[model samples]
Target: MSETTRSDVIVIGAGMAGASVADALSRDCTVVLLERESHPGYHTTGRSAALFAPVYGPAPIRALTRASAAFMANPPEGFADSPILTPRGALFIAREDQLADLTGLHNELQSEGNFKELDDSGIRKMHPLIREGYAAAGLYDENCQDIDVAALHQGFLRRARARGCSLFTRADVIALEELANGWRVRTPVGTFEAPCVINAAGAWADELGQKAGAEPIGLVPKRRTAMQIAAPAGAKIGGWPIAVDVAEEFYVKPVAQQLLLSPANENPDVPCDVQPDEMDIAICVDRVERAFDLRVGRIETRWAGLRSFVADKCPVAGFSAAVPGFFWLAGQGGYGIQTAPALAELAAALVLGKPMPPEMVIEGVELSSLAPERLSA
Candidate 1:
């Protein structure tokens, strides 16, 4: 039998959520991060074509995202070699039938961002590739931007390691048992014990929770498929913002010399390395061609990623109601990357029993809103 290891905290999953929280928690606690995969972020984090849309997701998420923008715009010295955020606006478009949805969304987020409502002419002017007769209106969010996912993710891991946190790959938890003062986690590598165990296992969060006797959060990992297609020759697409269907049926965004397209599918799936469905790819092409003045002659690449969510569509954070010393940190949906910085800070503070940070307070973070008990009730 392997000798039992100990740490102040054990964070499972080593992806953005685990790494960022480990970075924050490592400031005062000895942290040990574990990932089942051979490498951290080999799953959803690495597959994500990430963007920072402050007005995205539900209220809690938007609040967290707003709280995160400052750090991403200006991270600490040595956090990363390159800037984490680059300007890349977002445009939510609507057909005539969906104009009311666009109007309602605009009113809801008017104060959340630098927003402007555009008519069809205005929409076409902003995104010339959009079919002239397709769009009836648009809501432009100028504050949205593309995220340097790799740098931000690596920076968190680097900082955590520098702060004396240990990271282990191929550490797939097989069993979890609660001791009088802490919890024991058995994995392929060996056994680890910590006073606090954070379940940030992404799609497998609920499964891990079961092993630890924690309450279920009803996390459903939904598959979102995307594909890359070549851009037209001589098209200056760099300045074009991501064009999203206001109804969220599909969307297209420029990625270097190509355009990334997706049907915005939310098919529920189990925890695994999900792949793009042929039907989803076909739907993507149909939607993109119908919305834009372009044709999908060939798809350069295609893949799928899981965006887990609970019933409320808000992220779960805080101690388990059913199990002591076990924390729940999952269900970020597609907004995980954008909201990581602030969410991690919030989770770390909660874990250490510290008062909520002023940053979160200023953003109107409801202390009990993200608690695991909320879902239990």
Candidate 2:
């Protein structure tokens, strides 16, 4: 026996992307949000090292981040009791051999963020933990900040529900049947039909697309691990900015009175519940200790998450050219949280057949860059 339901749109994941798009579209249409897990954001969204770094991704991603800046900085009233962004600057440090890379990055990001180049002494002054002679130069971006990811995800979910959107957790999508005018999605709980079906299943997006008979976009899910260690004695870590190697060999940041570190590994992986590897943790500790004066105490906790990317390493958004009413909102890579607002708005506008939002246009987001047709072409 099976139950049946219908809506104007069916979102096939309840993570940040799904929640944001559902919230946006629910304003004028019926929305059904489906999650495989018992709770929303049980995957990447929950495990994100959430940061709003405008200069983190490629040009298209930076444009989206710029477009989302206003929303993150000042969310709508009643969205959350506290602000979504908090002051937590970022420092990209480089050794002598990586000076050119650091300079290039700083030059490229000057237009997108407030980045200042610093010499070894300046870098040491900003973050004294770096061992002497390890970092020859650094780039500081004060505009980077910590993001309250839970608040943002909950805000989207709450807004969507308040607007009459239905959310179904533990609704594993087993099949997708394309109808003449809509889609029939069979899940464990019931069958949901909608004219528009959005694929926002994060790392499993390519699998969902194949299930829907859409062409694979060659999305690769990569594993990233992070572990927390006790803060060093007599050192106040709360005020220290996030420190990342210019080549992304490793990164460390303060979290909940502990130091969170990652080797910045991106091992190709299949979509599933990810776990941290002991070798990766050892690599992180080795890299951090070699670069900084801090010794690693016992790893208090550790975890891993997947960050999905396409060949071009840019997000895929917009309607599919082959499959009518099938939308592509995947391949966010590691920039999903920072660029959610703009991408959600863009997805909604495209779905509604409306013009690009003026703000997004001003932010210099070229629709062609994000269109799914680009993959086929």
Q: How many residue pairs clash per model?
A: 0, 0
- lDDT string, candidate 1, 1-377, tens digits: 79888999999999999999999999999999999999999888887878998887889889999889899999999999999999989999999999889888888888887988898899989999999889988889999899999999999999999999999899999999999999999999989999999999999999999999888999999999999988999999999999989889998889999998989999999999999999999988888889999989988999999999999999999998888999999998899999999999999999999998899899988877788888878
Model 2 over residues 59-159: C-alpha lDDT tens digits? Answer: 99999999999999999999987899999999999999999999889777787778888988999899999999999999999999999999999999999
Q: Note the residue pairs that clash in candidate 2.
A: none
Q: Can you tell me which runs of candidate 2 are displaced by over 4 Å?
A: none
Off by over 4 Å in 1: none
Over all chains combined, what TM-score does candidate 2 have? 0.98
Deviation of model 1 at 237, angstroms: 0.9
- Cα RMSD of predicted structure 2: 1.0
Error of 2 at 33 (Å): 0.1
